[model samples]
Target: MLKELEKEWTENDRRDEVASQDRPVPWTLLASLAALPIAAGLFVGGFFWWRGRPARGALSEEIAGLSMVSPWVIGFMAFTAFPIFLSLALSFCRWSSLTTLDHAQFVGWDNFRSLFGKDTTFYHALKATALYALLTVPTGQLAALIAAMLLNRESKWIGIFRSIWYLPGVLAGVGMSVMWRWVFHHEHGLFKTLIDPMMPAGWHFPAVFEKDAETWGVPAFAFINLWTIGGTMMIYLAGLKGIPKDLYEAAEIDGALGWKRFRNVTLPMLSPVLFFNFIIAIIASFQVFTQAYVMTGGGPGHATRFYVVYLYNQAFDFHEIGYSSAMAWLLLLIILGLTLLVMKGTKRFVYYEALKA
Candidate 1:
């Protein structure tokens, strides 16, 4: 009986040992395994640090400068970088703002495909945006250049004129929208009122706000944008001021009259500024939202629907967060491509004073 009991006890011990061997590894062991590479990296980094101890003061100065700017770096990473990555991830997801992030399902290229293939509104918005940009950017730049030329003179009233021109830009947004709405009011508007007297007895101005809004919407916006030419005017004015007086004197001595002098001397010297303003205007025109949103609300049969307005409607109004993100990325790509094209095309024409020497 004692032998049989000992045999049973030995068999039970063996089973216990086998069970221990077969069991899954503990969390502690798994953590240690994961941290092995990290520990090695730290050791290697310490060795390098010790080897470079002679340059410690220079390193310390660099570190101090980095520390001074660390807050901005941290803020940019947290706010801008994180959001950009998150938005990019979400662009490939089937997500609605109505649901939580946990419910987001991975949807490969459906958002982009839908936009390019299925969505008719997307094409219409793109067309409208392109047309708007084409109309507004050049006209606005021309207006600004003219104003800059006029205001570049030295006079006591120059500041007042500058203030008057810039005031509209400063008071943009809702207030400007309201003013425009009043100005374009079909019957009672300042535009109609002023034009009424000049017209023949039977002739009347076309309804800019009513029947003509669909066809004339872009032109109307371009006109309104012309009012805020002050910002671009300032940039052009700065460029004009920077042009050397010697160039004008040389042109005059060479018998280059007003138009010739302006065409030859002024245009070449101002090419760089013009290129800068052109690029800025193009970008701003592509991303035009406020006036279209506030004034027309992308209305009158989607005639005034700009790209950003469409994106805004998709994200906020329609709750298509994923689709909106896709649109945003597409817009970014479009702008980037256009900017690169502009840069490449203008490489020969863009005058650099340093390069001339």
Candidate 2:
């Protein structure tokens, strides 16, 4: 019985091999499908390579070249490039909600004039947003740096603690904002309860809504923001883990203690990470929307009047699309300028690990 089974298996394998050898190849079908694109690319390349010799069949070559990238090129022009141009054009015009798109009369520099001249709200909001960025960016970087240092230390359950620190960041956006709003609730919130007990009978705990009160003058908006930025801190902690322990050991051998090791070794090594987090934090803080929109609606008289919120109000609520486009362009310029400044400044401080690489 075993001999018969072995013979049958051997025969089956032989039959499978024969069938595989006899099967038709798919190279013809693949080659046929690939030939058209390959031919077109070669033609376009040849055309560009011999630019002066491109008098003949230039239009045909251009057409063929465009045919390949038509979908992407068209989409890019329609969605991105055209819109940017349109916004730029719109910034030079004056248009309101009631005005038709075609009826947007050209009024050069009018919108920009309005932004800087009569618009005191824009000035106030911009100042407030700048102040928020100043407060949040430095503080957030310091917090992340401290967390990174703490987590870099040798510990068994460091991963678990790291997750705990990052937990606030993963909370659903709406849920996190709502949770923060509750914590900042003036009358019966945790913050109020904490402060109320310590105060005397005559002096009551002031709510966030009570703008008139001088005693409870805490900026609740800023507190809410800081609470949600714990996730960014975790990212820095991870960056710290990627650093070599040997560097620290070398520093210690050189008689470097806590502050010295941190200043000379840790700070220089982590400069790239710090630069990344600082720029990101600045951009995010400037465009702060969700927390302010959900919690305050840029209220308490525009206390949380972030740049994006202002843009959103201009676009949607005011129905000033042209004006909003102008604002968007201004913001784009601002962010681009700031990013360029960061890149330029990074050369002085950011330490790339060329020795290790």
Candidate 2, residue 222: lDDT: 54
Candidate 1 colliding pairs, count: 0
Model 2 per-residue lDDT at 56: 59
What is candidate 1's CA lDDT for residue 115?
A: 81
* lDDT, candidate 1, 1-357, per-residue tens: 223423542343211122223332243554476468768987998898667765778888866887999999999978997678668866776556897765555666867887887666677789888988899998999999999999999999999999999888888888888889889888899988999899999977766656786777777888899888888999899889888888889988999978999899888889999998999999999998998888777766567778998888778876667778989989989999999999999989888882242
Candidate 2 per-residue lDDT, tens place, 150-229, comes to 87777789888777777776773878878766776777778788988899888766667446212221255555556566
Per-residue error for 58 in candidate 2, Å, reads: 22
Q: What's model 2's overall lDDT?
A: 0.69
| Predictions in order: lDDT | 0.79, 0.69
Clashing pairs in 1: none
Model 2 is weakest, by summed lDDT over 10 consecutive residues, at 13-22
* Top candidate, metric lDDT: 1
